[model samples]
Target: MRASRPVELVCPAGSLPALRAAVDEGADAVYLGFRDATNARNFPGLNFDRDEAAEGIAYARERGSRVFVALNTFPQPGGWRRWTETLALAADLGVDAVIAADAGLLRHAARHHPDLILHLSVQGSATNRAALTLYHEQFGIRRAVLPRVLSLTQVERLIDNVPVELEVFGFGSLCVMVEGRCVLSSFITGRSPNSCGVCSPAEAVRWEETPAGRQVRLGGVLTDCYRPGEPAGYPTLCKGRFRVNDITYYAIEEPTSLNVLDILPALVRAGVAAVKVEGRQRSPAYVREVTRVLRAALDACQADPDGYRPDPEWTGALDRLSEGQTHTLGALHRPWQ
Candidate 1:
């Protein structure tokens, strides 16, 4: 059978307002995490409580938008019950799907709630077709969120080999390290990103003034220093400036967002089943703007396959709502230098 027409837009919803904004602006689905360690973006003041999640799900479904609950973090030893219970609750609350990364959690969801759709999280790092297929065989995963490491060509190849739906990140922050493969945060902060659902926890970030300028630090170790009028990026360890061969430069990646508005047609042709906009930490206005623009783009692509070009004006609107001044296609093309 020919591949399904382009893909739907999967937006993020960190709060009830964000969910409403996404649906109002036009999203086919929204993915969110619980206000606990079960989801990866578990920062303070983010995520929804159980009652709020149910309400959010109802709100989306009433508007013809689906909700996917992300129970994507690995369960801590001796704390698997929490993860298991969260999946059960999500099923009970009638989420359209549960995005999972951990094998144990996947097994639990499969056993207890076999009817629920399971989408593999990017944290699973299922980069190749073989790995993705293995998950399909073992856990009955309906979809796999392709990692940020594959190029458009590689994505096409992978899709040809796999027998499941594929979701690709269309817009968001770029992670230099492979998702779930990263241990840098744990090494520094003694907190596991895979288990705790947070990388570079906000409480661990600090800033101070130095004689030369100002210093941005993570867990008391200086990660970046900024002089007057210089732009200071978030002090994520992977994006920190470092010295090598007697010269200092950003060792992993510069602080930048990923804007693939210009490449949406290519991604569609590559057999992407869904285009995901990643920003659960973002504001409702951001969700509204992006969902609206991407919805229009997707509709245009579907309406005229051969004559579709994303609107440059929509891209500019997205750029205005982006996080940082720097933006890149990121590892989708090649490893960041």
Candidate 2:
């Protein structure tokens, strides 16, 4: 049951050091964004400027690793110029591919940089073969990162039917809603991940200490509260513990990491072109350890898929870095659905 081909390992690069860490730890490719609202993870003090991005690209290329620029944010009517400029800069830097979501931006990239590789971001929301085909035919997208909402069987079916390359989320935080389409954040905060490149932006977050517990609020709304010695989660409206029929709990989703270690072999055999690790806002140390562990796991699974089991040490290492110190199979396993 070993993999038929070596699946590419796509890691994240939030900063220059993280980019080096990803390459040093054997990532096949690293995805990053410019320090602007063009990319999805537009947090302060993160991402690379133009010069830093060039350096990162050079470092990765030297190690036989590819670098992808993420211009995944959609542009408003008046802001189309910025998205176009970001695409041009990414193409000029000789990036291996551009992970884009907006239709206009993709069309602009296809027309201006026809030779550059175009990868439809998960934000593009092409969950089925028909949508994938439309993107492939219209904009010449070579690959598409599937949203995490699909099950293992669904992914296999889409891969069997679609002509473009497929990439799936192997490990990372879980977003209950599909990427690019979630409007909950925008409703609560004045910003949206698709347009503003942020979710529960730090500027709008508030933390309060009380005798009862620690209270977390996002844009003046109580998101989560944790008692003494409890692991407090990030303040996101989706992962919040709320009252439902007199019981307070995480009704929508909990704060857990997505680890597909047990299903790596199935994904590889399903003809997945790549496995993406989603965390560009994490620290360099986080990037280093996660890349190292996933690289080992992927290599091990390829070598002996039938005999493969997730190493406890690797799981522990990732768990320490996980949100709420927990992990799940996400939507990959049907029973969880």
Weakest 10 consecutive residues of candidate 1 by summed lDDT: 1-10
Assess each prediction's global lDDT (C-alpha) against the native. Answer: 0.85, 0.91
Q: Name the top TM-score candidate.
A: 2
Cα lDDT of model 1 by residue, 86-110, tens digit:
8889999989999999998898788
- Residue 228 of candidate 1: its Cα lDDT? 86
TM-score of each: 0.96, 0.97
Q: Could you give me the TM-score of model 2 versus the true structure?
A: 0.97
As a whole number from 0 to 100, the lDDT of residue 144 in candidate 2 is 96
Alpha-carbon deviation at 261 in model 1, angstroms: 1.3
Tens digits of lDDT, candidate 2, 204-271: 89999988789988889988888988888788788999999999999988899899988888987788
